[model samples]
Target: MAVKSLTPYPFAPKDTVDKFPAPLLYIGWEDHKLFCSPVCVPMPPTTTFGDLVRGTLPGIYSAHPDFARIDWAQTEWFLSGQPFTPDMDKTLAEHGIGHKSAIRFRTPGLTGLNGSCF
Candidate 1:
């Protein structure tokens, strides 16, 4: 077998290709209304469930105190009716979760740190 020498592309990939959207996923979970507006989260395709949760939880809950109580570590992520494991190794791209992919987050119950737990 013979090997061919490889060289880098003359132009930066960014120069000729269109960039993916700034926000990579539409992440959301239901409230009393049964459906809530999904927050647009900026994430890379390589991000894992744990990474996404930890990375965005603070910002999301910071703005919406209503989400303050749910234990992020215990949270469950679902896409297209399938559960996402929290091993923190799965990448969104592996499951074809691409731009604007929808991810629903679920916790045991709705309770903020300040709120009483049932």
Candidate 2:
């Protein structure tokens, strides 16, 4: 076996990335929402996994007085005049698609098939 000499891609952003924890805290109020993505955010090698764990907590955890009583990750609250609920599980169940993985069968190879499965 032989090793080849190679260099890191030059065009890639050198700005260090930050890794975030899973089961992350997300916020949704009216038409606005914010959350971190495990699929999108990148972290530097220097950042310990523990730091990732702490970073996912609510941004207001450091300041607000009443936020401690609520699990911001699972609970929703409005900062403005919009109506909101703290129970994300129940709210999503009522508003979101329950069965995300429902199969839609299709056959592309069959002749005269319009992408439908019989």
Identify the candidate with maximal TM-score. 1
Clashes per model (N, Cα, C within 3 A): 2, 2
For model 2, the stretches where C-alpha displacement exceeds 4 angstroms are: 1-39, 56-118
TM-score (C-alpha, index-matched) for candidate 1 = 0.59
User: What digit string (tens of lDDT, one per residue) describes model 1 on residues 6-118?
Assistant: 87436443421136544367777644232346777667777775676677656764565556666767777788568866556676677667766788776677743333433
Per-prediction TM-score, please?
A: 0.59, 0.19
lDDT of 1: 0.62
Cα displacement (Å) at residue 19, model 2: 16
